[model samples]
Target: METMRAQELHSFYGKSPVIQGVSFDLEPGEFLALLGRNGVGKTTLLKSLMGLTDGCTGGLVFGESNLLSLSTSQRAKLGIAYIPQGREIIPGFTVRENILMGTFARVDGRREIPEYLFEMFPILREFIGRKGGDLSGGQQQQLAIARALAMDPKILILDEPTEGIQPNIVKQIEEAIIRLNRERGLGIILVEQNVPFARRACDRFMVLDKGRVVVSGHSKDLTDSVVEKHLTF
Candidate 1:
């Protein structure tokens, strides 16, 4: 188990500041829901956590290491895997190849894709020979997660895992995310737009607006009134 903490963090895209004065913590095996309206810096905040932003400041620490000081690959080697919003599966690559790509982050040089990933999403094993681009949006999302899990990451940073997915498949993805956190004991930082689902699945929730965390509390505190004010369009 590993813990992630970010304090007074700021991130930029070229000259524009996207994340300002953001701070959070993810204890081992905890689930956090990062929520906000559209155009907020939620995506940028997730990217900052992964060192994918143009630049970042303040402290991002995991255990005793300062993540802000490390390169993206260096962070990955330390067991932080990012599943970005678009899924980002290599189009022409076979499902097996796509999953194997995550193994490069393993410092021990282990190349085996975990059998549990196949159990989580059996479609991945059935379509192991299929090209990544040939799968549906939901299947591709599951494959994206499989690719990340192949690295044996300690913390999973997910950016809108359910965006643009079909309704039925969305439930499956939600269940899988919850199972990954509760059963597998993986720390989760999820960016989600589904209010009820977020409340149901997350242990705690934070609401980000204009790059700053404006309202945050335990999942039980994320009432409908709070959602109406911060999350509604």
Candidate 2:
């Protein structure tokens, strides 16, 4: 298990800072929850990690490689998968088609969706022919994650995975995250505002306030007072 570090990260849009000097480390197979209120730069930080934004300073390093210089596809090829907010499934594509898109980064010219994806999200197998737009919101979220899993990523950045999802489906996704970390040894950076669920699923968490990391600690060490001041909106 190697260390994953985001070192002194800073980013801005149109001369206004969005992520202000954030730093964090993720141990391999660790589950970290990124907790913050809306528009506090959580998504912007995730996008910066993918190198989609123009002016992200500092570094996102995976082992020995610096991610800041890599293009989105290059980062994807290096095993960084981002499932951004809104699920973002192609509405016109079938479930199978959408999931297969995750394989676009493969270098060996593989044309098929990897076999491990079906094992991770069995429900996707059932919905193979179904249109992604026709699925329930929870189902769409599942497909989005399954699509990311197909990329064989070392680190998965999931933004607001439980937003607008039913409770039962949320539980399923949580359990799946636990299994992935425990069994496959994948690192997860979960961007979520759902405090209770995030605390339950992640080993550690960081609080982002006004584009900066205000506090961070293990989930078990996060007290009620800490939650009220930083997590409550």
Candidate 3:
């Protein structure tokens, strides 16, 4: 796993800056949660990491490579898997085909889906032939995660992964994320609304308000007052 460092990063969409001077570090095998109210540039920050933004400036280094210099596909090949909000799996593709798409970014040229993905998400195995559009929201989220895992990433970036999903499936997804970090030792940066889960699962927390980071510390320091001040809408 490689460390991702963003120094004074700024991202713009058609000259309007959404992420302003945001800086942070995601250490190897670390789980960092991005907590903020809606439209605080959390999603935009994630997009910037993947080079999906209209423009970005300042330093973004993943391992030894300068991420700002790399294309979106190049970033993926470098082991940063981004699962954006809305879980954008191809609607026409079958579960099997959708997952195989991720392998196209693999540097090793392996096209086969890893068996452990099935072990993590058995629902995908059961609905292997089903189109991505046919799956329920929760199942589609699982498929999105499974597809990302297929790329064999060193770091996983997720944007509100459990938002709008069923409660039961939310637990499953949360557990899977924890396992990916704790058991598999994959680094993670999760944008989340569920404060309790974020506090419980993440090693560190960063709170964004407007476009800048207002609070950040170890998970243990994420007190009720901090949430009430910055997170409570």
Clash counts per candidate, in order, are 0, 0, 0
Q: What is the lDDT of candidate 2?
A: 0.85
TM-score of 3: 0.98
Candidate 3: segments with Cα more than 4 A from true spot: none
**TM-score, each model?**
0.97, 0.93, 0.98
Q: Model 1: how far is 148 from its true place, Å?
A: 0.2
- Taken over the whole model, the C-alpha lDDT of each candidate is 0.92, 0.85, 0.95
Position 9, candidate 3: lDDT = 99
Q: All candidates: CA RMSD in angstroms? A: 1.0, 1.6, 0.8
Question: Which structure is stronger by lDDT: 1 or 2?
Answer: 1
Q: List runs of model 2 lying over 4 Å from the truth.
A: 114-116
Instruction: Estimate, for each residue in 38-142, the C-alpha lDDT of model 3 and write its tens digit.
Output: 989999999999999999999999999999999999999999999988999999999999999999888999999999999999999999999999999999999
Model 1 segments beyond 4 Å from truth?
none
In model 1, what is the error at residue 190, expressed in angstroms? Answer: 0.5
Global fold similarity of model 2 (TM-score): 0.93
Better of 2 and 3 by TM-score: 3
How many angstroms is residue 134 displaced in model 2 relative to the true structure, after the best TM-score fit?
1.3
Question: In candidate 2, where is summed lDDT lowest over 10 consecutive residues?
Answer: 105-114
Best model per TM-score: 3
- Clashing residue pairs in candidate 1 (N, C-alpha, C atoms within 3 angstroms): none
